[model samples]
Target chain A: QQQVKQSPQSLIVQKGGISIINCAYENTAFDYFPWYQQFPGKGPALLIAIRPDVSEKKEGRFTISFNKSAKQFSLHIMDSQPGDSATYFCAASKFNTGKLIFGQGTTLQVKP
Target chain B: EPEVTQTPSHQVTQMGQEVILRCVPISNHLYFYWYRQILGQKVEFLVSFYNNEISEKSEIFDDQFSVERPDGSNFTLKIRSTKLEDSAMYFCASIGASTDTQYFGPGTRLTVL
Candidate 1:
């Protein structure tokens, strides 16, 4: 079973537009949710993260909207730029176990 | 910001040969982890290490897989008798403390032919 599932295997957006990616999870025990950005031939870099307690968290152009009851979360990029184009992955993890369950990645391409 | 470092960005080996992937996590980080991603698939966890010992591992971390922290800064994953299916990108990560954030390094891509 894919504990974490992401939608829109690929996304295309225009520069200065909004880019959104959604994810769902089945495990209620997951307390930590994080997003990662990866480029070709590189490891994923942490972008933004949130806990279930918070409804939303924003960092500059990146934002995370979380729904504890719905068991879903999403990442939104405001005023999306060409520099922001990359593969995005949503991941969930519980404490101590150190194992992170990742969703099928969404490749976001921004056209200028 | 100090980041984790990995060696040999890519490697190719014949099937049934042993291969070792190396990583150097950020200093002061207390926990270490290993993850792998096959091309066109999601990233999967392999194992976690803490206090110089393994804390947990996944079923995919079978007998052919082993991890070790042989020195103060080096963490290694050894795969014995690698199969073509073993070809993938291996990532190494570390968290500063139990409750803190985890950081990742550029992964090593291993190709078993």
Candidate 2:
């Protein structure tokens, strides 16, 4: 029930294109969802997050669309750039426990 | 901006040896956690600490693993006997009063041979 499944395993996009990654969870107990971006040999950095309370959230060029009833959420990177090329992870956790269950990261490669 | 810090960017130990990974969480953050990721795998939660005690732990935490907040600032994960499978990137995370947002530190790469 703690699983947060994400897809596709790998993504390729051209510059100035929109890149979208989707995730779904089986655990309804999860009230907090966050997306992380990680470069090679570094830790995951917070990208953007959304909760069940809101359907969508936008942070600069990154946006998160959440569907509470469907137990689904997605991260969209607008005007994808080579700098945005990295492993993106979708995580779910309960507010009280704060133990994040991460998805099988999606590696995004934005071609120059 | 305050962030979590970890020591010994890399550690190499022989099988059966003991290893400890240390972390200094963000000041004023009340909750701390430990997680691990094997090469090319998803990050897995090991444990969570609060108020100088373990608030929660995962099955992977097992008897060989332990956590401590010896001082007010440093949080540590100790593996009494390192196994070959224990080699992974261990991460420390913290959540402040918000109870939702968690900040992760640059992980300690443990290589058990």
Candidate 3:
């Protein structure tokens, strides 16, 4: 079973526009939610992470808006640039499992 | 910033052959893990190692798979008699503690023919 589901297999946004990707999870036990960015021929890197205690976390132009009750979270990129074009994955994990359950992934292309 | 390092960025082997993938976690990390991703698929957990032994492993990790920390700095994954299905990009990750965020290495892509 896919515990986490992500929408928009691919997305396109103009430079300086807003880029949004949504994800929903079935496991409420998940306390940690992290988003990873991966470029071609490279490993996935941690971009931003959030805990259940916080509803939102902002890092530079990247922001993660979390909703614990809805079991949903979204990543918002303000002022999207061509450099932001890459594959994004959202993952969730609990304290005990320590194993991350990842979403299918979203390929975002920010056009300049 | 401490980062994980993996050797042989790419490996190509014939079916029924043995392959060993190596990784070196951050110097101060204690928890180690292995994960793999088939082309266009989400990363799947293979196993977790701690205290010189396996703490957890996924169902996909079968008897043909083995993990060993041969030295103080290197962790290796050995697959005996690899099959074509074994082809994937293998990633090694480590964390300072069990609850800390994991740092991933530039995965090793294995191609089995």
Q: For this target, which candidate reaches the highest DockQ against the unseen true structure?
A: 2
In model 2, the Cα lDDT at residue B52 comes to 88
Model 3 stretches with alpha carbons more than 4 Å out: none
Give the root-mean-square deviation of each candidate in angstroms: 1.1, 0.8, 1.3
- Candidate 2's chain A scores what TM-score? 0.99
- Evaluate all candidate structures by whole-model CA lDDT and list the values in order: 0.92, 0.94, 0.92
- Tens digit per residue, CA lDDT, model 3, A1-112: 4389998899999999999999999977888899999998888899999999999999999999999898899999999999999999999988565688889899999998
Which regions in candidate 1 have their CA more than 4 angstroms from the true location? none
lDDT of 2 by residue, A1-112 (tens): 9899999999999999999999999999999999999888788889988889999999999999999999999999999999999999999998888889999999999999
User: Using TM-score as the measure, what is the rank order of every candidate, best first?
Assistant: 2, 1, 3
The digit string of per-residue lDDT tens for model 1 on A1-42 reads: 438999889999999999999999998989899999999898
State each candidate's clash count. 0, 0, 0
* TM-score (C-alpha, index-matched) for candidate 2: 0.98
lDDT of 3 by residue, B40-112 (tens): 9988889999899999999989999999999999999999999999999999998886445878899999999
Which candidate number would show the highest TM-score if scored against the true structure? Answer: 2
Number of the candidate with higher lDDT, 2 or 3 = 2
lDDT leaderboard ranking: 2, 1, 3
Q: Model 1, B1-113: lDDT tens per residue?
A: 79999988999999999999999999988899999999988889999999989899998999999999999999999999899999999999998874546788899999999
